[model samples]
Each structure stands twice: as C-alpha cells, then as structure tokens.
Target: MINNKTIEKFREIETPFYYYDLDVLRSTLDVVKKESENSGYKVHYAVKANSNPRILKIISSYGFGADCVSWNEIAAAIKAGFSPSEIVFAGVGKTDKDIGAALKEDIFCFNCESLQEIEVIDQLASKQKKTARIALRINPYIEAHTHKYITTGIEESKFGINTWELEEVIKRLPSLKNIRLIGMHFHIGSQITRMSVFKSLCARINELQIWFSSRSIDLKIINVGGGFGIDYENPDKSPLFEDYFSLLNEFIDLLPGQTLHMEPGRSIIGQCGSLISRVLFIKNGSNTLFAIIDAGMTDLIRPALYQAHHKIENLTSAGNIYRYDVVGPVCESSDTFAKHIELPETRRGDIIAIRSAGAYGEAMASRYNLRDLPPSVFSDDL
Candidate 1:
C-alpha cells in the first residue's frame, strides 16, 4: 500500500520506478525462514525472479541459498553475498561456457534438464578435473493450471527430462564419471496457486522415489521447484508459506539422510514491491477513459506478456471512483496494464501503483523502443 507520505515522495521523483518496501520483503522472508526451518526444508531463492542486488543481498542475509539459471545470475548471486557452495544452477540451454564456469565455481548442484546437458556437464567437469554435483530435473507431467508460457512439467515442454527418458538417463549415469548424481528436481510452472498441484507433484515424486529405490539408487535431495502464487488483489496479504510447507511435509515420503529443498521466487518477493508510475495523460478512448501512464511494457512486461491481472490504484486521488483503462506509453497496443479497472477520479500527474509486480517486473525489463530502463527506489531511502 502506498501511503500519503510515500505518494508525496513519488511526486518529487521521476516517473516509472519500482518501489520496494524492504520491511515487507523482510517480513515475507521471516515467514519463509520460519516455515522452512520448522519443516527442516532448505529454501533456495529463485534468482531468475528478481535479481536486484539489494533484494538478493537481503535474501542471502537470511541464510537462504540461491537457484540460478545462468552463469551471469550465478555470478550476481555470489557478488550479492550468496555463497557459491549454497547456489544451485539450472537451465535447459546451458552453454559450454556456463557449464565450465559453474564447474570452476563448484556450485552446490546443477539441475540437469536432459541427458545431453548432463553429458555436457560431465565433459566440462572432466576438463577441469572436478566432480560436478547434479540433480536430474525430471518431468513429472503434472499440470500446474497456470499460464501456458510458464507451465513446464508437461511432456510437450522442453524443460525437464521426460519420464520415458529416465531409464536411459539412469543407465548412462554410470558412464559419466565426472559427475555425481545426488538428487531429483521438478518445476511444474510459475504462479501456481492450487495446492492440489503441489500434492500431485509430491505423489509423482514418491512414485519416482520408489522407482529409484527399486534400482538401489540412494538419492540425497528432493528439490520441488517453486511456483507458489501470491494474492494480487490484496498486496498486504502474505503468501501461504506455512500451509505450503505443511502440505509438503505431509505428502512427501523422504528417506533417511535425504533433504527436501524448494526454489521459491514469486511467493517470496511478489508482494513486497510495486511498479510506481505517473499518469502522463488522460485521454479518452472510443469507449473508455484511458489513463495513459509513463511506464511501458519495457518496465514491467507481465501484463503485456501474460495478460496478468494486477490491482491498480490511484495514489493521489480521493474523489469518486470510476472505471478506466490503465495503459502504458508503449507503442504496442498489447502494452495495456488493466482494462476497465476501478480507480479514484484520475487526472494528469496522478501517481499510479501497479500491485504485485515485484516478482518479474524489474528482472524482465527491457530497453525496447529505445526507452531507458526504470530505476528502483527502496522505501528505506524515501
């Protein structure tokens, strides 16, 4: 929530900036830490969500590990105070250069998505005379019931190794002498709100565990990749960390010495930050009032890319509410944020707050159309 004082501060600053409430972030982290600690589960903050240096440093301060997708992200995590020993690298299209870099750093684990990737990591590890720890990212074929672009566990997805290929993967693991297989990883999708989806994933993991045990394979880690969603309508409501951890504990059957891990991204950071923009113009569309904002898809692309809904608020107005089509200055017609959304009577220069933007907002920003990237403003500084 943007208080009156914060809204006043926004007037002094430039338009189209990310406002991060550090207190909100710390409170969310406190819940995550408490829940994970109670269940003895390890949490690796998914670095791909929001790799802001300050965000990463704050999460690292909680003694949480990091889950990175690229060598660059891994480097950023390390630079932000995340220990290399607590970082797990994951990606479907990891190049040899990245594999070599991760091997050199000796990161905690490589969430290998395919046999080819595992072979490449093995070769890279062999070249460096090092043993790379790996976890097979198996496709459980579970539907997370989220947006298609974010769903990954289905057979058609190009992410994890399919169930049909597991025999070959396990058969070939013996020949990859430079790599050690220590775990299994799964990421069904992002923005998953249904707890049943996680329950289904746990059932599949248990089945796979039995299969591995039948072959006398002793896996040491079970990483259920994160996709927990947040309440976009209620920005102040925290994520269901306690319920999520409790659900995992009840359903997943872990062997002795095996550790449970999660890679939460959105649920940890989504509510703490918002996209703050200034109303540049109040134009009338054919059928609706257009509150054109200075921020564009380049600043926060989730709405344009996924048609995601974010609660919009007019921070400076206290007049009677009216419906408006909140839009951006981007040339693309698809750059709309919310359509026919209710807001206080708005005018030019009114501050706008796009709630639930902390996850993929700044991290996915671009410089398209020659627009400069939006800057971040921490609440502490204000």
Candidate 2:
C-alpha cells in the first residue's frame, strides 16, 4: 500500500519510476527462509525475476542460493554477494560462450534441458579439464493451467527434455566422461495458483524416482522449479509460503541423503514493488475516458505481453470514483495497462500506482520507442 507520506514523497520525485518497499521485501524473505528452512529445503532465488542490484543483494543476504539463466545474470548475482558455488545455471538456448564461462566459474550445477545441451556441456567441460555437475530438466507433461506462452513441461514445449529421449540420454551419458549427473529439475509454469499442479508434479517426480532407483541411480537433488503465484489484486497480501512448503513435504517422497531444492522468483519479489507514474492527460476516448500515463510498456511489459492485470490506484485523489482506461504513452495500442478500471476522480498530473509489479516489471523493461528506462526508488531512500 502506498501511504499518504509515500504519496507525498512521490510528488517530489520524477514520475515513471519503480518504488520498492524494503520492509515488504524483507518480510517476504523472512517467511520464505523460515518455511524452507523448517522443511530442510534449499531455496535458490530466481535471478531473472528482478535482477536489480539492490534486490539481488538483499536476497543474497538471506543466505539463499541463486538460479540464473545466463552468464551475465550469474555475474550480477556474484557481484551482489551470491557465492558461485551456490548458483545453479538454467536455460534452453545457452550459448557456447556462456557455457564455457559457467564451466570456468565452477558453479553449482547446470539444469540441462536437452540431450544436445548435455553433450555440449560435456564437451565444454572436457575442454576446460573440469567435471560439470548437471541435473536433467525432464518434461513431466503436466498441465499448469496458466497462459500458454508461459506454460512449459508439456511434450510440445521446447523447454525441457522429452520423456521418450530419456533412455537414449542415459545410455549416452557414460560416454561423456566430463559431466556428472547429480539430480533432476522441473518447472511447469509461472503464476501457477493451483496447488493441484504442484501435487501432480510431486507424483510424477515420485514415479521418476522409482524408475531411477530401479536402474541403480542414486539421485542427490530434486529441484522443483518455482512458479508460486501472488495476489495481484491485494498487493499487501504475501504469498502462501507456509502452505506451499507444507504441501511439498507431504507429497514428495525423498530418499535418504537426498535434498529438495526450489527456485522461487515471482512470489518472493512481486508484492514489494510498484510502478509509480503520473497522469499525463485525461482525454475522452470514443466511448470511455482515457487516463494516459507517462509510464508505458517500455517500463513494464507484463500487461502488454501477457494480458496481465495490475491494480491501478490514483494516489493523489480521493474524490468520487469513476471508471477509466489507464493507458501508456507507448505507440503500440497494446500498451494499455487496465481498461475501464475504477479510480477516484483523476486529472492531469495525478499520481498513479500500478500495484504488484515488483517481480518482472523492471527486469523485463526495454528501451523500445527510444524511451529511457525507468529508474528505481527504494523506500529507505525516500
């Protein structure tokens, strides 16, 4: 929630900036740390969610590991105080240069998504005279019931190794002496609200565990990639970390000496940040009132990209409520944020807050349309 004082602070700063409440982030991290620690589960903060240096530094301070998709993200995580040994690298299209860099860093493990990727990593490792630790990212073919663009783990998705290829991959592994298989990884999708989805993943993991055990494979890690959702409507409400951890403990059957790991991104950082903008003008559209905002898809692209919703609030007004189509200055018609949303009587220069933007908002920003990226503002600084 943007308090009266914070709104006043917003008036002093430039519009179209990201505002992060450090207290909210710390509180959310506290819950995650407590719940995961109680279950003896290792958590790797998904760096792609919000790789702001300050955000990364705060997360690393919690002693959690990092899950990175690129060598650049790994470098940022390391600069933010995350230990290289605690970082796990994952991506479907990892370039040769990135793989070589990760091999040199000797990071924790690579979540290998394809058979060819495994071979490449082995070759890279052989060239570097090092043994690369890897975990097979298996496609469980589970329905995440999320947006199609974000859903993975299906047979049609190019994100993970298909089940039919597992036999061949296993047969060829021994020949690649430079790599060692240590575990398995699965990420169904992002913004998954249903617990049933996770339960299904656990069941599949258990079945795969049995299959591996029969083959005398002693797996050491079970990494269920994170996709826990947050309440976008209610920005103050934190994610249900306790319930999520409890469900995993009840369902996933782990062998002795094995460890459970997760890579949470959105749930940890979504609620603590918001996009602060100002009403550029209040113009009449053909059928509705348009509250055009200074912030656009260039600053936060989730709405334009995924049709995602973020609660819009007029921070400076408390007059009679009216409906408006909140839009951005981007040239694209898809730059709309919310349509026919209720806000207090608004006008030009009124402060607006787009709630639940902390996770992918700033991280996915672009300089499209030749606009500058929005700067970040922390609560402590204000």
Candidate 3:
C-alpha cells in the first residue's frame, strides 16, 4: 500500500516509473518456495514475464530454474545466475541460430512444440556432437476459460503438437538419435483462474500418458506450463499457492521417478509492483471526468491489449469520491486504463499507482512513439 507519507516522498522522485515492493516480493517467493518444496515440485520462473535485472537476480537467489522462450531470454537468465542445465526452452518457433545456442549452452531440455522442431534439434545437436534432451509440448485441447488471445491448448491454437500426431511422433523418435525424450509438456493458456481448468488438464494428461505407458516410454519429468492467475482486484492478496500445488498432487497421477515442473511467472511477481504515474490533466467531459496520466500504452500495454484490469489509485488525494475515466497520454485512443472508475477528486500532479503490474508491465515496455521507457524503483531504494 502506498500511504500518504510514501506519496510525499514520491514527489521528490520521478513519476511514471515502476515501483516494486521488495518486501512483498520476498514474501511471495517465500510462499512459492514453501509450497513447491512441500510437493517436491521443480518450479521455474518464466523469464518472459518480468526479466528486470533486480527481479531476476532475487528470483535466481532462491535457486529457481528459468523457463525461456527466446535466445535473449536464455542469455538474460544465464547472466542473472541461472544455470544453463536448470533452464527449459519453450516456443513455437525456433531458428537454427537459437537451437544451436541452446545446444552450446547445454540447457536442461527444449520443450519441442512440433516433430519438425525435434528433428531440427536432433540435427543441430548431432552437428554439435551433443545429445539434446527435449520434452514434447502436447496440445491437450483444454479450455482454460481465460482470454481467447491467451488460450493455447485448444485445437486451433498453434502452440503445441496435436493429439493426432502422437503416433507419428513416437514412430519418428527412434530415428532421432541425438535427441532424447525426457518429458512431456502442456500449457493451456495464460491468466488461468479456475482450478477446474487445471483439473481437466490433469485428466487429459492421465489419458495421454497411458499410450506412453503401453509403449514402456519412461519420462523423467512432467512439465505443466504455468498460467496461475493473481488477484488483480486485491493486489495485496496472494494467489492460492497451497491449494494449487495440493490440487496437482492430488490429481496428477505421476509415474515413478517422474518429477513435477511448473513455470510460474505472473503469480510470483504481479502483486509486488505498481506503475506509478502522475496525473497530467483533469479534463471534464460531458458526463465524465478524465484523469489523463503521463504513462502511456508503451509503458503498460496489458490494459489496451487484453482489456486487462489493474486497480488504479490516487496515492496522494484525500477528497470526496468522484468517477474518472483514467487514461494515458498515448496517441492511440486505446490507451485508456479504466472507464468510469471511482476515485478521489483528482487533479494535475496527483500520483496514480497502477496496481499488480509487476509481471507484464516493465518487461513489455516499448519505445514506440518515441516515448522513453520508465525506470524501475524498488521499495528498498525508495
């Protein structure tokens, strides 16, 4: 919570910056560690979510593995102290350069989305005189009940291998000498709020694993890709980590010596950061008041892109409640944050804290429209 005293100090610093609460972050990581340890789960922090150097270093200190999508993410993870063997690469598209780089690094496993990708990795690994460990990312066709844009496991999604292709994959696997199948991976979608969605996923995985069992294909890992959602309405509240892990343990029937792996990103860091922006103008419209903020879509695109909600608060104001159309200074009309949201009677120079932005906020910032990217200020620094 940004109190009045904190807001007073914020005046001395620049507005339109990301302010991270290290205390909250540490507490969140503590809970994640406790829960994952209780279940003996191998948790990896998804580097794509929030790769801020400070955040990554702190997470790495906790000894969490990294889940990466791109070559740069793998590089960043390595630079931040993540062991190459503890990293898992996953993406729909992988160029030869990227594959070769991962092979050179000897990353733990590549979550291969296609049989072609398996062949490519096998070819590259053979060239490098190294054996590549890979996990087949299967399309479970489970509806995550999240936003359509984020849904990946459905049949129409281009993220993973379809169910029909499993037979062909198994038949071709014997020919790929340099590539070893170590696990199977599944990711339904992002921002998954329903536990039932995950339960459905467990059932699908159970059904699919039988085919492998019949073939005596031993898997060392079951990498369930993460999409755990955080409470956007209540940023102070933690996600259901205990319930989440327990649910997996109770439902996911694991084979002997198979380890559980999850790639959590948003749930671990979303509540710990806020995008602090100053109110640039208080314009009165015909039937609404507009609180135009200095920060734009370039700084935080989730609101514009996914119509995602982040709790907005005027950290300085102490006045009568009033409704405001909180918006940003971006040229596009989609730069709006919230519509007709109630807040204190806002004025220019009022600092607004956009809550629960720690995950996708700073990591996704861009210099589009020549807007300068906002710097992050951790709570300890403040």
RMSD of each: 0.7, 0.6, 0.8
Consecutive 10-residue window with the lowest summed lDDT within model 1? 1-10
Q: lDDT tens digits, residues 139-189, model 1?
A: 999999999999999979999998889999999999999989999999999
The TM-scores, one per candidate, come to: 0.99, 0.99, 0.99
Model 1 stretches with alpha carbons more than 4 Å out: none
How well does model 2 score by local distance difference test? 0.95
State the lDDT of candidate 3 residue by residue for 1-382, as single tens digits. 8766677878988878999999999999999999888899999999989999889999999999999999999999999999998999999999899999999999999999999999999999999999999999999999999989989999899999998998999899999999999999998888999999999999998987897999989999999999999989998898989889988999999988999999999999999999999999999999999999999899999999999999999888889999999999888999999999999989999889999999989999999999999999988876
Clashing pairs in 3: none
List the global CA lDDT of all models: 0.94, 0.95, 0.93
Best by lDDT: 2
Q: Please give the ranking of all candidate structures by lDDT, highest first, separated by commas.
A: 2, 1, 3
